[model samples]
Target: MTEEEIIRPENLVYKKPTLLNDTPMHYCPGCSHGVVHKLVAEVIEEMGMENKTVAISPVGCAVFAYNYIDVDWVEAAHGRAPAVASAIKRLWPDRLVFTYQGDGDLACIGTAESIHALNRGEHIAIIFINNAIYGMTGGQMAPTTLMGMKTATCPYGREADLHGYPLKFTEIAASLEGTCYVTRQSVHTVASIRKTKKAIRKAFENSMNGKGASLVEVVSTCNAGWKLSPEKANQWMEDNMFKFYPLGDLKDTATANDSH
Candidate 1:
């Protein structure tokens, strides 16, 4: 089928492309960040927050996310997206605010910012992209790098004595009293994409309802960094990454509030 036939106007009625820009993303083929971006944009469009949404992009491969998200975005300093997000949300309490950060940006350099933001009960959404390796800076050793995983800096494999352990960011963030909704999902396949979209929509909706900080960690793929074929990289994330970052809702107070 032709591209026009696939994204026909009728099909785009409710499922329109909320993401912006005509240029293709710089992500390697089969990268999951693109899917995650699409999911977030769709949720914003569905909720009619296109004009009210603001996003902070981290200093990673996703740094250029502003070009694609079509929302008013601020390019934050490395590891400072959370700080920027906090300020933006506070300055304009009526706007829906979020930050898109990678494992290195969020789990490593921005660790303190992330923890404090969640701890402060900031009503913002965090789209955490955990691919285990630092994708933008030549696949360096990231804080979330798995034990025994090899990287540019850790060619001998990640050693506990030197590199430390992989971070369970969602779990840690959820533990904070400020976070109201926390979940981890993946986008390796069509079915997984659907599930991720649901989780992302819920997170945004919860934040809009005055539900404090919400986090949605997306276990993503880095075919180039992992040195695997596109299909193989996805398979690897599904098998290994999912094992480390299990998929599910960590907290859902709104649904619980309604049900109770």
Candidate 2:
């Protein structure tokens, strides 16, 4: 069979219910955002939360995530997904609420919103994708950009003196008394993707259980921003990003094991 026939629409089995409207994605080749988008949809299907779930889209590469994840979603102002999530969850306390955001939007522009949201102990799940650099804004230096990392605006490589240290968001979230679940996982490999799906599902479950705030920080890849092939990009995330954002549960056991 031809390659097209191998991946035909009918050949694909979507076992889970997806609220995502039918539309093609605009992500670059080898982008992990697409994989993550699919994982969220799958989790929503598995948990039967698509009808009662609401997602919040951020301002970075994933700003259009609402189009791909089958669920009710709102577009939040840059760096304000957490705030938007708080508002939505407050209004509809029974809904399973989440926010899909990138490092640039979550760690930089939205730092205040993020910190305050967690501090307030809102009932919502946060799906944070840390790709290191700014993927959408022409590969600029993001707050999570590692030292010695090269980006369009940092051709000389990011330096501690100038760019500051890599922000450990999971660690920060873990410190919050209100945060119920905090885990850092990756989507760079099959094993890691399996773990990431579990983390995502756990976060959603925590939200449904009214367990306060939950954050799953996904160490994802930005192939275009990193200027690496898909294989190399995944390798970089596994080797480098994993060192900084280790995979595991960082908070309460109930929320951590909710998916299981």
Per-residue lDDT of 162-224 in model 1, one digit per residue for the tens? 877888999998789999889998888778889989988887877778788999999888888
lDDT of each: 0.86, 0.86
lDDT of 2 by residue, 41-136 (tens): 888888987689888997988898877776787998899999988988999999998999999899899999998898788989999999998998
As a TM-score, model 2 comes out at 0.90
Each prediction's TM-score versus the true structure: 0.93, 0.90
**Which 10-residue span in candidate 2 carries the lowest summed lDDT?**
12-21
Note each model's CA RMSD in angstroms: 2.6, 3.5
Point out where model 2 deviates above 4 Å.
1-17, 253-260
